[model samples]
Target chain A: MEFDMTKPVPETQPWSEKFWEGTKQGKLLIQVCKDCKSKIFYPRKFCPECWSGNLDWIEASGKAKIFTFSTAYDMVEPKFTDELPYTIAYVDLEEGIRMMTRIIECKPEDIRIDMEVEVVFQERGGYFLPYFRPVGKK
Target chain B: MSKGKIAIIGIGEVPTRNMPERTHWDIIYDTCMEAIKDSGLHKNDIEGAISVTPQAQPKIAAELSFGKLPEELGLKGCKDAVSVNAGGASTSNAIRLAEQWITSGIAKAVLVHHVTVHSTIPIPDLINFFARAGVDLQWEYPYGTTYNIIMGLMANRYMHESDCKPEEMASVVTALRSWAAKDTNSFFYGKEVPSVEKVLASALLNTPLHKRESNVLGDGGSAMVIVSAEDAKKMKRPAAYKLGDSVRYFSGTCVMRDFYKVAEGFVVTAKEAMAQAGITKEDVSLWNCYLAYPLAHPLIAELLEVAPQGMGGKYFLEGRMSFGGDIPWSSIGDAPGRGHTGSGVSTACYVETARQLMGKAGERQVKNCKYVYQNAGGGSGFNNIATIWGKEI
Candidate 1:
């Protein structure tokens, strides 16, 4: 499939390149501070908790639970207008890291706080963006 | 940060409405002059200047950055001038900066002002711009979350944890808007006070939030003058004395922030500011917690313990936050009732507080106003700058 130009094409920095590369291979990678032993998301160059550059990556299990969510009935970015009635959420991964993503394969009424979810990737240009789905969904 | 030794002697604002007719420079100049005139002082009386950093810059909120405000305002060799940014806390942070200059005798007085234009950009693009600012451009913006959507997520979690209901949210909106309806200064002035049903019927921008639930930005700007107590006495004008002060900027972006940490931030800021003011929550005559959205109604109430758990909605519904109500909230209706003046809304909150303390809030003034507790922030709720004010030093 041709990459859609209408979709948001994310650029990667040096520290976030690995996470983007992992996504291209359909692997979810997260950062952990070797200094503080704290897991980090969003691929910062330094650990937010400890401000240490001594960070390493580990493959995330992709297991998560909905911390909170909201379904957009209207008023989204122009590019995402076609995906209206979409549910956006923040989920707490099993690794104790929180990340923002869209919830696919769920209805506005069915989504509940604390509901278990899993990650899936959608390709965008040279990278894949991670989105969450209810557990066991293909 | 001063020990009630400095006070806001003058305040100014333009109407809170879409004014494509006026450039940001015009708005800034108009409001600044209004404030200087209201202060009963010559323009040269202000020797120090502090500005709240403009928002959504290079398009609408641009061109006014750096420390050029004093020069732009024609201050002759001003002693000091700088800009401060902390999201909604911008103006509050600017006020603290002014206090430092005034108390340190770096300047006889300081002018703190803000301008965030919303009319220059199209609505959708504007939403996209603010959304990108609030989240990580790489990780989160691609996921299609606007400020409204992020706030929606927060509103859901807060409502779920606290058992806040949709009807209660409407009630809170209604109460907040009534204050706006009473004040000629509010954009919503002379507009019908929205009923709870009207709020429920309003279009939904995101789950659990009607279009009216959030503080959508508008073309607005405000300014204020902070002078030493000696100046206030010489002028023989009642001033809103700066008492306690606490300003903080925590983690950036709401998704990455810890809720408990922010909750603790609120408590700590409130405690420290109140302690410095030598007062308790009971002593506060007015409360202004930047309630950018409705859930903030209950959320702030609960965080500040103004209302018991999950009862913030009921508290608003009961009219406890309205004019003549216990701890009247936002004399001129604040962001939800007044219009969100970009960064200036926080400055405007202080303006309204000063008006109430000076017995000049017009029809919307809260009676017996003495002490005011205000918290303004960016990142929705991630950061906080809480301060206390009194009628006299």
Candidate 2:
């Protein structure tokens, strides 16, 4: 059973609507702090570090390095079970914040602690979800 | 300059569940009542309460139980009640809050509880939230990068760093299984401990880290009533005093800055807590460390100088968990026995130490145990907390 890509999201808070909207634009948007100039993920209005209200939205280039990662052989969910072995990774963005993304177009064994990767957006249902691929290689 | 003195006067815990069926509310109610009962006090006696749970609406405590709260355990004349959200660190961190309130003379007694219906919630999906926060969530969660895999990454790195064999980790599983087999309260009662060969042969969730090393997703809740030393003496239940505690955050999730810093940092935290408790590692009769993976023990041991270089194995020659027994994470080989519970796992270990201290643990009790050491690791690969608890504060 492939995860029904068309399944409606069961819940969505008001603030998170922007995040969902970003996927539609094929752009990854993250909040940036004014005081400390740090990037915030998890879609929060305030910065957790300095409690800075001076925040701005910035588009990311999505180029990152795999600080560490793992490949799953089992499918706990049926949505993507057909592709039994898949790689999920912690990609350290040039911005200094590491975001979790899937490594596409690379063998599981090829994933190293410091591999360079770039974001590739895919259209999942109506949302353009961001996955990553190796920079030089296909 | 306020001296914060918070003593856990009364403790209440539900029987552990193989797969927790009840809602967070059900578990909270049960443990809260047990704690209030243990305190020999009524709901009205509680002046302040604090809680940390997976649920967002903590005021449910007041709504469910007569205009009172932390959660249905019911506290009357309450002025200060907070719902903290620090994951596994929440329970003990709640203790820190209680100490603050009591030292300020704000609340004479504070009730803190953590519970969850593990079977009901989508465990895998929820754990993926941490991933969504950092990584490209849409990509990582869809195919691979769940918390388990993230830990697998850490475990892989750890294994590469040390000579810790899979068999040594399996021995940890065997010891946990051995203890759980004896504990009617444990989920794996009567189950045979998997042999080293069996563990090695198990599915590799992450390279060199087998599936058995993780914790079984069990359900349960644990409650502790924190009070001042004077208040504890008046309480009916025997107390497990908070001798000393510390919370430290390592920089970044990556292993760059604070990763290697953990071993030395752990020793510092432990030494500080021990010094405050007026005891040394030599005085600790039992040790219940939070073993997320097999690599933590040796890494921690090496860092603490528990043994000289390359002799970390010698420290475990004689102990409750010889060679790193039943770790709490992944239950990869059931090292800590059951797989992880969100919060209660750490609290339960503390409860186990409390049981041993009170002479309540039947067969598993350590002899002449006066002090017990408890460690709680939060946001794996990032936050670490250590606390020392004893019969005397």
Candidate 3:
């Protein structure tokens, strides 16, 4: 059954717009503290480590490894019903930042902690949503 | 302020179930009135009030709707009134705030109130509420990371790191169900306790989380009245003194912290509260660790040093967390069996602990329950509050 892909879209704030725009352009951008060189995810206005406002964005390598994962077989939102058994995972990027994303192109049972994976963008609701899949898989 | 300066003199809780007909305000009113009556004090004696809710509604909304609990409940001399919105940690945080108010002379008597009516809303709306309340809306919610999924991720990581078998996780549920069966107010009351095999065979809501392992959400309300130590002595009933309290914070997201070290904030908050109480783990007579998810029981146990790290499941398997165990944990059932009602968990924990300390818990009471340690966390370990309640100053 085909499900409605018109799920809730994020209301981007001024600071996070660039990160979303980068995702649309097929590049994973992460914020970095200009002073302390500490990498940050989810695009915060100030550096969590150094409290530095002098921040810059760097394109991530689009590579990460699965830190942990869970597959939802039931009790999901109606909009997500068609995507039954979808795997949600937290992946550790090589830059030392962790991202919450979906894992596709593999059986749910095959997903394992610390397994290497890479980012892939899927267009939804006129926006590019980043998901991850096991490395070396089509 | 020094420890044991404030005491929970009275507590009350409304029956927990799916009460779609009742509004959140209605439940709050009922619980607060019941608590005041239990305290044997006039409403005019309440000088301060703290309200807690987990939905997107702000504290101001509660006051605007409920008309300042002090006024609605006919409190004539109320001087301070505030609403707390720390999610699951709101009740514990509210209790801590009440203690501070009594210690600072801001108020001689304070009432802490909590209510949740999520079941009154539509399922989809409730799901949306959970997503918006706990997840990072701009980045995580859009990606479909709901609260259950976040817990699922945590459970998966915890199992992987601890090498905790599926059967051991199921045992946590089995044991909690047995406890709930004994509590008349528990959602699982009158229900047959599920065996470990039954729990393991239950349908999986999310991979690694059986249907029995997740929280059974419901609607409920609870209230507690706290007064200065001097006033507590004059109360009609025995009082549960506030020995120590601490609130700690960590990353808002599960991915930000080391997955293997999931209980970092719990450990910090527990230690701080214990130290402030001038007590150690051995001194605690009862333990009320929040168990919204069965996987959290062992993790929190390990964090609190009730059991060795990675050996919490073993503690449960050996029947150590049961009523007859050396350390009586969740004798009235944790969230999974008692029912998860937003801020009601912590408030209910306080009420249960007070009852045990006062020798009021008939069947579920623990022996020698003098010092009761109750702890709660909010938003997937983003915030935590630990409180120690003693039978004496």
* Candidate 3 chain B: worst-modelled 10 consecutive residues by lDDT: B56-65
Model 1 chain B: ten consecutive residues of lowest lDDT: B58-67
CA-lDDT, candidates in order: 0.81, 0.62, 0.80
Kept native contacts, as fractions per model, are 0.85, 0.27, 0.72
Per DockQ, the best of the predicted structures is: 1
The clash count of every prediction, one per candidate, is: 0, 33, 0
- Write the residue-wise lDDT of candidate 2 on B1-393 in tens digits: 122255565667775675545666677788887877776767777777776655322344334334335434446557766766566666667777778788888888778776655566554454434344333333245444455576666655555455555566555555556666666556675678666678777787655456665556666777766778777755645667778776567744342333557666788888877777878887876666665555456556555555565544333323325423422211112225644556557666665656665666666666666787777765554567777777754
List each candidate's DockQ score.
0.56, 0.21, 0.55
Residue B219 in model 3: lDDT: 82
Per-model TM-score, in order, reads: 0.94, 0.73, 0.93
Docking class for candidate 2: incorrect
lDDT of 2 at A82: 62
* Quality of candidate 2 docking, DockQ: 0.21
Indicate the docking level reached by candidate 3. Answer: medium
Q: Provide the lDDT at B50 for model 2.
A: 72
